[model samples]
Target: MKRLIRRMTHLRHSDDQISARVRAVLVESLYASPRSLIIGALTSSAIAAVVAAASGDEWLIGCAVLIGLVGAVRIVDALRMRGSATVRQQERGYRIGALTYAGLLGVFGLLTLTRTDSGVLDLLSVTTAIGYAAGIAGRNAGRPLIALSQLCFASLPLVFGLLLPLDPLKALLAAVILLFVLAMSDITQQTYAVILRATTASEEMAALAEHHAGMARRDDLTGMANRTAFREHFEERLRNLTASGEHLALLWLDLDRFKEVNDFFGHLAGNALLVAVARRLEQVLGDRGIVARLGGDEFAILCGVADARAAGCIGSAMLEAVRQPVGFNGHDLRTTASIGIAIAPDNGRDADTLLKNADLALYRAKEKGRGRFFFYEPLMDEKIERRRQIALAMDGALERNEFELVYQPIFDLAKGRITSCETLLRWNSPQFGSISPAEFIPIAEDNTLIVMIGDWVLRQACRTAAHWPADVTIAVNLSPVQLRAPDLTHAVLAALSASGLPPERLTLEVTESVLLDDVDRSLAALSALNRIHVCTTLDDFGTGYSSLSYLTQFPFQTLKIDRSFVIDLEHNPASVAIVQTIVDLAAKLGMRTVAEGVETPAQLDQLRRTRCDAVQGFLLARPMSAPEVIGLFAEQAAFRSNPGQPALPGAD
Candidate 1:
């Protein structure tokens, strides 16, 4: 009998285990369906009502009410959930879900207090179970699986109640199954929400990283590759070309006199000019090359060309690109560029070496007169090395005071007397010996040493003029580079003040080329000097595009005829006629004219006949030391005293 009891106990334990497993599966399946949850609740309530009505118990009515209320609350929740899902805004959906869940739970709690008959309560319980099962199943399967599961579960209690005696065990078992199903549903929902959040966070992180990397690679101002990215890309291309036996070229481009643009028009206009230049380069190069701004007025291009000729073609295209004028700040601004090209495998195999060679070529291109390009060559490299040595030696030369000034007399045609002396620059390099102005002036201009050289010239000229007669003016040729320096006007004003010389006694000679580069700025500088009573002269006139329009546009106190015309005065009638016309024009404009390079008496005679206001040439005196000039004046005084009068011809 004991052995039989043990077997029976073991069988009952196995059945309990199987029932728990079935409950778990049902809970999980129903949790995934929305409609199943509402159906399960309704079935549970109906079963509770039927049980309460058949039993005819007063306490059973309370259970009936509780079951009905749970069903009604879940039904309302399912409807609200559907409504929330239809909303477009995510926040609004979440807010409605939270409010609906809370309200449903409150209604379920309130319904637990009312009483009803046992049969009715039992029917209500069945209805509630069905509604809950249907809601959950619909939510999981997107169908009505919950209603089927609840109907199946509701029949368990009804079948047990009708087949056996009434017991608390059946009621306890029903409550336990309901709680188990609810727990399973909550777990499924929480797990799905976690997965969704993880996916969203990952996508957001990827987008943010991509955005930052893009920003890092692009130039902030010009929207091109920045220097760092350019370097990397250049290196990669170099490697590819080396492997493929293909050739590439690097071009270094620099805008001539860009600083003057910044100084005159402000940074806003300067930025506009840079952006305009970038667009032009892109349009010109197209797919032939990649262009990058190497910071402030300097740009570079990398071209994948097969030969030097192809590279030359690219350079020519770039040159033509910048030839068009750019309008900025309501003014048409004209700019020119000097380009230098270095071929890979010919110039250098590496980035640094290639860039260095390209820069050397750029120096040569600028020296050859800007708005042109030069290819890298062995001879060009040699010349660059020589200049580098000279530049190094110049620093020491300045310290040792190797620089000297020479004065050339400016003779008045009307008075026939020396009225002014123009200061000429002379550099004596101890290592190189007497470097010519034509050679080193350009080097200075390129390296920006002209600012320092110009300052020295201005100070020396002012000091010399202060010692001379107050009426005699001193003319100093201001280089285009020096004029573009940020503090140029201030430097001139300070030099005049420091030397105790009057502004009226100082004459600044500017070339036609200076005026063409940023005419607005050039005019502004000239106007400022004029306001200070400084005499402004257009030097080297009739040489470059003699636009008389500039005369009306710019204020000038004097016009110096270039030496080219003066040198041909005796041979070329056209030269004579041109000089005559210039003098006539000056007279009409009420401007003074100076004839330069008057080496012969014939040229001087011609200039005098033309009513030239001044003449500066070897005929009067070569540029000499200040003391030598004073000595010459004394010699001339002595010669005048002895003149049995083979006297110098007075203004004819």
Candidate 2:
């Protein structure tokens, strides 16, 4: 039984198992073809040599030559099978080889059936048929169709010859031969079933394995490689870099303000956006690098170039590609990415280290500002760890009420009194002594805690200011995250109602950066606020990309000149000219202008002469506690209403 199984089976299989034909060729190359060729060549050549010695028959000699030619062809086909022949070539070779064997066996059988008359010839023909049957049963069972072909062509004519003699003994012999042919045919049919079953099983197993492999390596949503694939590929590239003495750059990119897309448009749109982004990365990077999705809104690239400048150029190109508008269901959605890069051997020698360093650089790019790229530096890791610690501390700071707002008065220059106080959020955690807004706010934004914190800030600021004099308004800066919230207008209205602050007494300040993404949504949100008489101010004027355009689109009652322009106001003509131009523009547009960060007397004098509507800085009044602001207002209420007291020098 074991011997039969051994003869029936082929090679188990190789790892690259693709199709059944490939498996058959591999098996025949290793087993069936060579064995059958050896037996057939020895039997035919020896019979031809013997017949030539006994009768010197030219016909038999010619048949011998034909057999030799067939043998040679089979050998060539076998060689092709063993080598690098393509699947099509291998299948074609197998078919031709099988046909050649069938034709040669048919010719030998015909010689016995029609032209042969000698006793030795009769014996030779019978012996050849019997041997052929035995050989095919053993050697060709694995490929049953070819085995049956050879069996029929070799045995059927011998049976025909025996029956034509018209004798009872010969008739009986023919009956026996026919029975043998029936038995061999049955074996071939059964063998075909077994071979087909085995091949189909193998194909099914291979398909299942391939499906699992795809699942493990590919992201189901984006169809790009997943984290496991990224790590393996990145590490392999590192090894190649070591051997080739070349450099590889690893880029970690994150979509800027991507959550807002999900928040506003729903997860389906966000998912479609991710798929589009993956395709865009493939289109932009092409063969220059490998792109993989690290996880939501984050992707990593492995580029062959080690040079920072070349990588930077590639990064810039990718940025340009992503910045194009993606049209979805007639809505044009735009997005940008922040990229961080780390070079191989310079950043790290392994995948984990390289990914880590690249992530560190990514945050730096975000910190400097989003929609840019930064290279990895040692100091970045320290900053990253610091941010991580701050993020950990901020988890419950709101519930604990560790957050407070300090009011910095915005002075009314023409009125000679304080008009509004800008509410600035402050966090003095028990774990970390007073964390800077610059540091903790970004952490909150990254962790998706900004909206909750912003809502809390708005409610608290309004509640605190509602107790102040009705004329003193409260101004609050809204995060882009908060602006993207669907219920932002409702949140503002709820805050005012909860605080009993009049709608007109609350102002919301926003940057042009907030409006850059989903302009329609931001515009709608600003309009909603304005409809309720909530004043809108464009904060950090001249600092964002499109100031003039923003002023035209949004109903901004006030424009605050950025601190950058104010710092060098007296010393730099460019600064003075910018402030003058902004003031002039604001006046013509009927909007108030506030110059922030005023420190020296000359800066204040220049701002007032330029007809700036208001000023807010340390020179006038520092950010103070609510109680301190209440006391200052109480002390100034009588003096302000008197209308006879001169304003403090720069406070105006």
Candidate 2 local lDDT, 1-652, one digit each (tens): 2432333343223213446554554345334467566667667656755654455556656776776677677766655554576554654566566556555654665565456567786577567656766577556665554565567666766777677768799789878877786677667657655765676687688778989998899998988899899888877777677556567998899999898888887888888888888899899889987899989999988888847888898889888888887888887777899999998888888888988898889988888878999999998888787887888999999999999889999988887678899999999999989988988887898888999999998999999998898898999999888887988988998999999999999999998777876678889989989999999999998877888998899889999999899999888999889999999999899999998998877888888888898999988889999999998787677776776765743444
lDDT of all predictions, in order shown?
Answer: 0.71, 0.79
Residues 1-652 of candidate 1: C-alpha lDDT, one tens digit per residue? 2433353355335424433323333333323354655654565556556665665665565656665775676567555554333322322332334233323322322232123224444434444543444343334321112222232343334434432434566556555545544544444345434533454465467667887887787778899876777788889988888656568989999988676677666788878888898899988888876888888888999978888999899889888888777898687666789999999988999999999999999988888889999998878878888887887777756568989999998887776567888899999988999998887887777767788888989998998889886668899999987766667779989999999999989999999988876676688888888988898999988777746978999899899999999999899999999999999999999999998888888898898788888898886778999998778666656656774543232322
Write down the lDDT that model 1 would get.
Answer: 0.71
lDDT winner among the candidates? 2
Off by over 4 Å in 1: 1-220, 242-245, 283-289, 320-334, 388-400, 482-489, 605-611, 636-652
TM-scores of the models, in the order given: 0.63, 0.75
TM-score of candidate 1 relative to the true fold: 0.63
